[model samples]
Target chain A: MSSPEVLVHLHQKAVLLLQDDANKIEKLIEVQMENLATRKCPLYEEVLDTQMYGFSREVDFAVRAGLIEESAGKAIISKLERNLAQLYEALDQKSQLL
Target chain B: MSSPEVLVHLHQKAVLLLQDDANKIEKLIEVQMENLATRKCPLYEEVLDTQMYGFSREVDFAVRAGLIEESAGKAIISKLERNLAQLYEALDQKSQLL
Candidate 1:
């Protein structure tokens, strides 16, 4: 038995979008983290404030649209937050060392 | 020797947003990937189309607003596309095998 094809496709696409964004963010974090570690200036903040919230809002939209479960979206956000906190802490420490 | 605080802040935020989304997407891909690998049902789609496009739209807004450079936004999208392509291919392969 297959799930509704449209819904299934939506589910697939939803995760794909999130996963794609996540990968993009990971690389940015890596580059910025390197910048922080090396005492180079960090970049991407000006855009990030708007961009990150925008993406999260999209996820929220998905939940609202019933394309995906709220729980899953929340889980993704929780994980993302945890990762960001760690990255922030690492950058903070590195910056302090300089 | 710091840049103008406002621009600097914006730049920092921009990258943070992209990076955070990237992190969130990475986990979604990972979970879905595992699902595919195990020949289990895969999930997350309808929502992603809107969410991903929404986030990208925001990135476009950032560029238009002059919060971040166009090149950086393009670069993020390009990288994200590459990752998504890779995941899609992998899933396709696994599904065919099953």
Candidate 2:
């Protein structure tokens, strides 16, 4: 019963929402890294572990919710994972610098 | 007094550290989004706001530390900001869905 325009609007909105979630997750990862580097807190590791799990869940949810095609979700998740690996390497270098 | 090879190694190490920090921050953001979506917690907003600020600081520090070229640092920060804005939108949508 929805018009094409309305459907398009809904789709656009959903895409925006998914993109926003990805951004917030990115910020969270940065904050945790700072905490880990500065405090050497044990909780830092826990936070990182939890965040990784959350990233997986988010990717799954995006696909299941039909917010992204499975191929698109896989592509995005794969890129994210690569970025994450690089980030870990960066942190290790920072520790060495300190 | 440093050899070119050693300098290259140092540069690589620094780049690696910054990348690691970025990845960890990304993970933290994901956890916060999930928490916000599920719990309607005020703390979630606080976490996001703090994270954005942290991202800015990190980007600034990365530049000051000579960890990245100024142009590259600016590009990265701009991208991060755009991503954070998208994340806010995603969380809002998630709330609406709930």
Best by TM-score: 1
Q: RMSD for each model, in Å, please?
A: 20.9, 20.1
Candidate DockQ scores, in order: 0.04, 0.02
| Candidate 2 segments whose C-alpha is farther than 4 A from its true place | A1-98, B35-37, B96-98
Residues B1-98 of candidate 2: C-alpha lDDT, one tens digit per residue: 23445445544654565566556667766676666636666775676566555555444444543445788767766666666677778877887887
- Writing each residue's lDDT as its tens digit, candidate 1 over A15-73 gives 67766766676666666666764654445653444456666775665564454588988
Where is the poorest 10-residue window by lDDT in model 2 chain A?
Answer: A1-10
Name the lDDT of candidate 2. Answer: 0.58
- Alpha carbon lDDT of each predicted model: 0.64, 0.58
- Whose lDDT is greatest here? 1
TM-score for each of the candidates:
0.46, 0.41
Give per-residue lDDT, candidate 2, residue A79.
64
How much does candidate 2 score in TM-score?
0.41
**For residues A1-98, what per-residue lDDT tens digits would candidate 2 score against the true structure?**
23444434434554565455556657766776666546455565566555555555544543543435788767766765666676677677877888
Which one is best on DockQ?
1
